[model samples]
Target: MSLHSLDVRQTALTLLRSGVRNAEVARKLNVPAGTIGYWKHMDRAKRGECPGRGSHDCPRCDGVPLDHAAYAYLLGLYLGDGHISHYSGHRTLTLMITLDDHWPGIQDEAEAALRSVFPTRGTCRVRVKGAHNIKVYSKHLPCLFPQHGPGRKHERLIALAPWQQEIVDEHPWSFVRGLIHSDGCRITNWTVRKGKRYEYPRYWFTNVSDDIRALFTDTLDRLGVAWTNCTRYGKPYNVSIARKESVALMDAHVGPKY
Candidate 1:
């Protein structure tokens, strides 16, 4: 086949495997619609795997190399409230993080974290459903989010892989930021004593998983951020950083959500 024909076939197959319709792929590539359909038919006859869909096959779809800060942040989001999934019959992977609709700058931050990891592929899309949610699509999500498996994260043994542990060791603060921003919050507290009122800022992270909570506390310890842990009656475990110095450290590193 001529180089031009080869390029067209490759592009056509990529678009098709991504679940794009033949007519749309034809329009995007300026090829005849029938040409795309024909190519897809031929490829199916050969029973070849889609370029980026199979396990550990395509280097391009193998998750991006772990960037210490970026991966650490992404890992936190995953452990906290994020979800990763591959819908039945779909070749694309979806990574979603839901945030409070009222939280300012959160969408921007989530998008930024995604872009940092994805860089090129997978456009991050935001939708509001009672809360602002960010979703990014990519075929490499399995590689990036290997922690995804059967059952809830709390029900599963959610331990970091060697690579993830290395990143967290180097950039614990970013990991903490992502975890806190998702499952934790920073707020001001008010108290009264002897006819006077005082206000203080505190940071707290709550989660049901013991392992995840341990990871959060360990990261805090590594950074020398003072924190206290407790379990509320019939509630998830809570970790609070209320000391002024520790809060200041967190503010310098993680800051408020957004």
Candidate 2:
């Protein structure tokens, strides 16, 4: 009855290859749905049909290049709201990014970013959860996003690897755009002085992880973007760029979200 047994794996693969759905296979074998997916993924890897970056000897192996803008954007997404998980007994990696459904065109931008990083892979699968969130999933996630580790992102030492750092250094604006698009927002703030109404636009990014906060702030500094730090009481740490010129600069690079 063990799901890890070779018999179970072979049966699951056969069922999957024969057009059986993952949920059905899991239900019939009394195994977890994830287990079925893991087996199917492994089988595809063996057949050299795994998506994203392909096999080492693949003719299309020109997989996602290192130090590319798309990779930087994906890294930002990962640091912001993405998650990575490894399938048991397989080399499969699942990368997921969940975004608020209310953000208009953010979902399309996210899909574009993922596709740019995994050109060989088809469109990522999207699932609606709860009432306000959209989740996207792809199997080749780990190849581009290697920041996966134990515990919450803030609790760990979240420094970038050398190669990633190099890419970010060369393409700071894209990195910043990705980070802001995920964890930050551009909006107008209203105030009243002596009964006179005034409105100003700004950019804000917040995160609970100190290391990630530092990374974000440092990148901003390198880009010569001025910002200030504050706290959200019981919530996350905050970094805001409210200067008129700074907001204009960010708009030039990050633009306004559709």
Candidate 3:
């Protein structure tokens, strides 16, 4: 066909679908640069009109990451407290387990286990339709809920940085206590009576860290810090940053020397 007889829209669609540059199309067609985009976008919305898989709209939303609002919204929907939509692509309500990820690739198992553990009334099925690799938060999810399938031989502690190791070795309780918030919720938070003892962050009553034996020596020995022990020289039942008025309490206390 003669160049004058060519359909720009048809030509644009063909080129755009192949991931060709619009400028190249414009240079060939001798038309405005944005005309290809305008035609392609308009064509995509009409059913059966899109050029091909790589066309302007065919995988348009594919591989685009979800934003925080969408993520949080999906989470809320799982607990039955937010909007649920059949047409919406995000359907599963997933909470991660707290262990480091070495689990076999059985997201389906985890999804099925979630449905079994926490039943829902929705018609849509819970499924591992996707795999999300978040940097930190999601890494520990499977650890807290180990029933995704079968757990392995043991749970390994994460290797700490040098400073963290010093803290871990010396004030192990403090190290463990500090991790509750960063990791998932702790077991003590789930206990009934023990959970009610504190009034601040509910997490204060929950998580437990790996206990290091050096905590009694390094933590209590620090001058100007006051901690209480229920039994003399035993691990503390209650420990705190000493109040200014209570600084005097440390004077008479004998720390676990050596």
Candidate 4:
């Protein structure tokens, strides 16, 4: 299973396309998962295939670009109507792209991308789990938004500010699996696991505590908020489009929202 030959790399790509995890393929090939990722990137770039690097310009292809809105909308579809994975409660979608971080400008980047390839069925939004280092993330990022400290972004209460909260109340997340965010400002190289504690910065509505938690949760509930959480990914509720609001708050106020 050595991944040294051209045949090995090609076989690995076939395996990945056939729904085999890189780890399993690597094990079968006896190569490292990173090796598989490396080869995949190399092969795609060499072939001149659009890398879908989280951008709206897949000018090479007329299909949907890998934008946040598209991703989020698909996830919501999965959550509301798609079958649950046999191994997981969360419905997951993965993309390999280059980035410097996974937040703040993400919605901006995503929204713009979505508008370019906008949907005719419905509005598109995004809710993702990111990691830190912004490098080669598979699922969740580690150490996302380090400047904000650590743990579920409890300090972001002000993000659900009154008017903003009002918007959430009005829209109420519906038919969408919640978006989970990680600390990765760029790309995620990791995912959550049993032994691994999620060090990525985040905020969640599922099981939110405090009367203040009630404030956020109740508003979302009244508005029909629905999101999903990976015991290993992000929070477990539908993500709100205050994608703009979250950005504004995080950008302007770095402390507890209140």
Candidate 5:
């Protein structure tokens, strides 16, 4: 006979399905960790689902339809400020995107995009040192983000697959918005010309990776947005969009991060 009630078991299963760690669920429900583990094992057996392997509805692996716009945005965010790490002793991989805590809207958008990309999976937000990390776990993240490889992104060459290229081509604005949200920003610059003050808004994308900068500029070219390379402290480390028409287009689509 099971020591725990059916209600308790069901609650435990629900939390487990949402990717909550066993220890967390146990603490929340006031149950023993070993007991929770055993319950999870038995529940998987009952449902004929493989443990550790979990359930995957990956668009790449399972042949399901993908939200291309959401994915394009997520790809930008990933390329800008996201990373994937493998869970030790498990087949699961966790994807985390860090955003400034002050921009709650951007954080929310990031979370929504991640959920849209992985509707069947669960997501969590954690705060660390003035930033919020939106994280999700899946076994097939590698299948989706083939760009994931060893070493810092700036240290390696990054290229897009054919299918990813198609998505970015279709949803360039979303991609730009994601990149801007991650590593780019808009600011107003002022100057005095003929004793008259003039102010203009400009977009700046700074990344150490030449490949990533190329990707951003290439997308801008496709969108008819003009950009220039800017030097900071004697280093060419920024892409500046200051053309009036280009800034207008960016304002129409991306605007200032909020």
Candidate 6:
């Protein structure tokens, strides 16, 4: 429940709709600027209006120069564990990436990528059980992430746009890093032979989407990283990079999530 009166909140919304900045509205209403920003975000969400709709900052719409490396990494993250959803009437969209709490460092990197790609938009973190949902609202999320559509990503075809492919081509390691951070991991296995123990480090990428797995392997092939399909629990959904050379490459590039 809101502590502020309905009328006061409405006045703030009205002022906001009429071009008053969030800080000015906060001053006029004696509300905290952060509260005002929240109100504005919710109000815009309710009305199905993007907070910065029609602004000339969208990379696709405004021809803004995109940070290709950041975007490529983010794209991999999105493909691995990201989601985009529409609110109200589809005018506003929210992009969310659910990350495990065990890896706060990965969370920081994901947030940095989001900010680097969409520098002007605000990003927030919502805490859920055992994880965090890093969220950003925008009207142009679809433009940036065309893979967003109705139904589960694995249920639908996931293909990259030509430009996105170009970016991934230019920054394949970054893309692999994002994917690894999101839905993949590096693990060490030890074995004993002749009273000696040896440890083998390998990379595993697991995704239900065939296309996504293919994309990961394709990029690995381009990078000269050998990979193989591994079946676990009766499902062939894991891509394993256990070859010494490939593991070395992965260690040099993606490494284990800190």
Model 2 RMSD vs true structure: 8.4
RMSD of each: 9.6, 8.4, 19.2, 18.9, 10.3, 8.3
Per-residue CA lDDT of model 6 for 1-258, tens digit only, reads: 237999999999999999999899988888989788767766654443444445788888777778999999999999998998866544467999999999999999999999999998989999999999998887677778878777898998899989889999999999999999999999997899999999999899999999999999999999999999999899999999999988999999999998
How many Å off is the CA of 51 in candidate 6? 14
- Local distance difference test scores for all models: 0.76, 0.73, 0.33, 0.36, 0.88, 0.88
TM-score of 5: 0.78
Q: Of the pair 3 and 6, which is ahead by TM-score?
A: 6
Considering TM-score, where higher is better, how would the candidates rank from best to worst? 5, 6, 1, 2, 4, 3
lDDT of candidate 2 at residue 30, scale 0 to 100: 89
Q: How many backbone overlaps does candidate 5 show?
A: 0
**lDDT for each residue of candidate 2 in 97-178, tens digit (9 for 90 to 100):** 7777776577777777766666555555455763122333455443344456667888877888776788899888888887
Clashing pairs in 5: none
TM-scores for every predicted model: 0.73, 0.71, 0.20, 0.21, 0.78, 0.78
Count of backbone clashes, every candidate in sequence: 0, 0, 12, 32, 0, 0
lDDT of 4 by residue, 105-145 (tens): 54443333334333322223333344221111111111111
Residue lDDT tens for model 3, 132-178 = 22111121122222222221211323232353334335443333322
Give candidate 4 regions above 4 Å deviation: 1-152, 156-159, 174-216, 223-258
At residue 236, give the lDDT of candidate 1.
60
Question: What residue pairs clash in candidate 1, if any at all?
Answer: none
What is the C-alpha lDDT profile of model 1 across 1-258, one tens digit per residue?
223478778978988878998899989988877567657754642342233434443333554354568778878987897887656555456788887877658667777888777776555557677676678776556556667666788898778767678789998988998999889999999999998999999998999999999999988888999999766896768999999999999999888875
